[model samples]
Target: MHILILGAAGMVGRKLLARLAQDGQLGGTAVTRLTLHDVVAPEAPPVRVPVSLSASDFSAPGEAERLVAGRPDVIFHLAAIVSGEAEADFDKGYRINLDGTRQLFDAVRAIGEGYRPRLVFTSSIAVFGAPMPEPIGDEYLTAPLTSYGTQKAIGELLLSDYTRRGIFDGVGIRLPTICVRPGKPNKAASGFFSGIIREPLAGQEAVLPVSDSVRHWHASPRAAVGFLLHAATIDGARLGDRRNLTMPGVAVTVAEQIEALRRIAGDAVVARIRREPDPTIERIVAGWPRAFDARRATELGFTAEPDFETIIRAHIEDELGGRIAA
Candidate 1:
């Protein structure tokens, strides 16, 4: 099957690409072609599958059409401006996140002749703002607190509506904040969640921008790629009309994350974290969901790290080659 991955250059996108290449299949079907698109050119991985790389803003006119012209069996829409960056730049955020998504969905719809692809969209838990229960469930209303959340929420509605119209088989996964992200940080509001762990593990001092008491949802990059793959193959009829579902995640406080790091790495590594609270980050994080019930997704066979330590360990194993700074 031919597969298309939007935002193929991002960390999660690259991981998904690697997993697909290693498995050589999607839902047991052999992957014959890989069409990767990103704002910047994605480095071609040394894989046997025939690959096509394109660098351009998909939100631009006619670009989305060119992407779906191949009629890939599965399309993974992982591209977005992220939370902090979206909130920082309103026009660019809406242009890329909201407008680009609509354009792509429309492009698929325009391809009639019974052309339907499994469109897996990466959404976020931020869709359900603060003023929520401890473990938010699937039935909760989507009252987003940030511009990024608003964009994703709109995309979710569009995905469902388009699917109902027989445009495409869509599945929206509301992802948690992926922690211990490898490489340098992007402008995501939750980047600090990974920063405090990633930087210190490399023997570098890291800032704690929020209070230790701050709690939030988290998942590992490995688990996230799994979610994308599963969504691509899961039966659409089983999902019924609710095409979007929150994926399972480990919920923990900032203090708990630090404790987990200390337990695994030792006192010196944990000591590298310095607390210098930033009000901007604190205010933004305040309106985010802390935990989730995710019973629907759990019943549907999605899984994640049970605890923060396992997430840390996964990062260490996958990115750090099972080794960290002393």
Candidate 2:
């Protein structure tokens, strides 16, 4: 099958690419061609798979058409302006996150007859605003606290409506805070979540922007990739009219994360972290969902990290080669 990945250069996109390249298949079916697109070119996999790379902003006029022209069997829409970046730059955020998504969906709608492709969109937990109950459920209302969340929630609504209209088979997976993400940080308010663990394991000092008691929902990069792969092949008929689902992830406090760190890498590694609260970050984080009752996703076969320790172990294995004594 032909697979197209947008924003293929980003961290999640790159990981998904690597996973696909290594497996050489999707949903147990052999992949024929892989088309990758991003504003920044992703690292070309040194694999024998037939892969093509393109550098183009999907929001650009005609770019979406070009991308959807071939009518790929699966399209992974992973491109977007992140939380802090989106809230910081309103124009850039709406331009890419909202308008860009619309362009892609429009392109899909304009396709010829019998073109029902699986459009797997990567949304975020930011879609839910504050004043929420302890654990958010699949039926939680979306009252985004930031422009970024609003954009994502809007995209989810669009995906649902479009799917209802039979324009395409779309699945919007509202992802949690991806912890222990590999590589450098992005502008997400949740970046510090990954930074604290990743940097400490790399033998570098990292800052914790909030109190240890700050609770949040989280998942591993491996789990996030699993969600994408599952969405790519899962039967949309099972999803019905609800095009979006809250993905399953571990819910823990920052204190638990530190405890998990001390357990896996000793107190010395945990000591690498310095506590310096940034109220700006804390305020933004306060509006996010503390936990999600993702029973729908769980029932649908979506799995998450067993605990904070599992999250860290997955990171150490995938990003640090199972060695953290550096």
User: Each candidate's TM vs. the true structure?
Assistant: 0.99, 0.97
Model 1 scores a TM of 0.99
After TM-score superposition, the amount by which residue 321's alpha carbon in candidate 2 deviates from its true location, in angstroms, is 1.6
User: Model 2: what TM-score?
Assistant: 0.97
lDDT of each candidate versus the true structure: 0.95, 0.91
Among all windows of 10 consecutive residues in model 1, the one with the lowest summed lDDT is 42-51
How many clashes in each structure? 0, 0
Estimate the overall C-alpha local distance difference test score of candidate 2.
0.91
Q: Residues 251-283, candidate 2: write the lDDT tens digits.
A: 999998999999999999999999999988988
**Candidate 2 residue spans exceeding 4 A from truth:** none
Clashing pairs in 1: none
Report the C-alpha lDDT of model 1 over 1-326, residue by residue, as the tens digit: 99999999999999999998889988889999999999999978777878999999999999999999999989999999999999999999999999999999999988996799999999999899979987898789999999999999999999999999889999999999999899998899999999999999888999999999999999999999989989999999899999999999999999999999999999999999999989888999999999999999999989999999999999899888989898
Give the lowest summed-lDDT range of ten residues in model 2: 41-50
